[model samples]
Target: MGDYHVRFCESLGVKFPLATRLEAKQIEPGAAVAPKTYRFETLWMALNQTNHERYTETNALEQEKLLDKILVGNCLSFFKSLDIFVEA
Candidate 1:
């Protein structure tokens, strides 16, 4: 998952700040069992610019401690969405 995030981020020229699987579970014991995509809260979308840039540049090792706050806030805002095609 770390590799995937790194590759994905590199392809887009952006930083990857998500927690690794083990770190995520440690941060929220049952997070591993949740859906791959999370539903972020409104306040997560409301952080200020300076704070956002600071977290985005924070070292990946230290970022783990801030992952839940940082990633959930920016994932939807930062990433492009794909239009999935479902076969009828």
Candidate 2:
């Protein structure tokens, strides 16, 4: 997942802040499970000048609220409210 995110960010000339591998665990014997594989998580951003300024101007609490709205709330509406077009 992290590699995919990194490649995606690179393709768009964005910033990939970090990639951290998740801990791996063995499946129980005879357990119904899919094939095991490495896992990762990354935070990537593709900020335009206006978006960058909007983000940078916010305080920590404001930033967290914005992030929560985007990540947990309705991201489409959030973007629409800001008139921001995000591909994919």
Candidate 3:
């Protein structure tokens, strides 16, 4: 997961916060790696927060804006996952 984050951030030309910390570590041969899980938890949490905010928003325009942002974010995430799979 850390490697994925490092690679993804590097691909975007963004400096990952923990990049230095990750580089300082040396894994022994055959060391156990962290278990892989679905990578969209943050996106799901953001979507839920957006949904909550939209529900509470009094203006229809604001609600539409929130929905549009969520849709666009989801599309971007989907495309990013496709890119990762293609690379794999």
Candidate 4:
């Protein structure tokens, strides 16, 4: 998971944050919705590392916006896994 984050940050040309919301996702397996599992393949399934490598190697500044969108989507998935509720 850390390796994936490292690669992702590198690909995005961004420094990693000291605290990441991904920590919640990593520690809580019960958070996943569909399969109820938080496997690497499941979390990273949509990402094609090969394509990302080629894209980053090209140094496409224009794609940073797209990458930010992808990161936002990933964060949303993590947020969705949160069990936030209230009972009165």
Best by TM-score: 3
Error (Å) of candidate 3 at residue 47 is 4.7
lDDT of 4 by residue, 4-87 (tens): 877977897987454444443446333344644333422343447765665577556746665666765776676667754322
Off by over 4 Å in 1: 1-43, 67-88
Estimate the overall C-alpha local distance difference test score of candidate 4: 0.57
The residue-by-residue lDDT of candidate 2 on 1-88, one tens digit each, is 6688678769989874673456779853332358565333544343556756877899999876765555534546666677765555
Residue clash pairs of candidate 1? none
Q: What is the lDDT of residue 59 in candidate 1?
A: 90
| lDDT, model 3, position 63 | 69
lDDT of candidate 1 at residue 67, scale 0 to 100: 65
Task: Indicate the residue-level lDDT of 44 in model 4.
Answer: 42
Better of 1 and 3 by lDDT: 3
How far in Å is the alpha carbon of 44 misplaced in model 2?
3.7
TM-score winner between 2 and 3, please give it. Answer: 3
TM-score of 4: 0.32
Clashes of each: 0, 0, 0, 0
Residue pairs with backbone atoms closer than 3 Å in model 2 (clashes): none
**1-88: candidate 3 lDDT, tens digit per residue:** 7678678768979773452432256643321368444443232324475578665765888866876787667756776665632222
Ranking of all predicted structures according to lDDT, beginning with the best and ending with the worst: 2, 3, 4, 1
Query: Model 2 lDDT vs. the true structure?
Result: 0.61
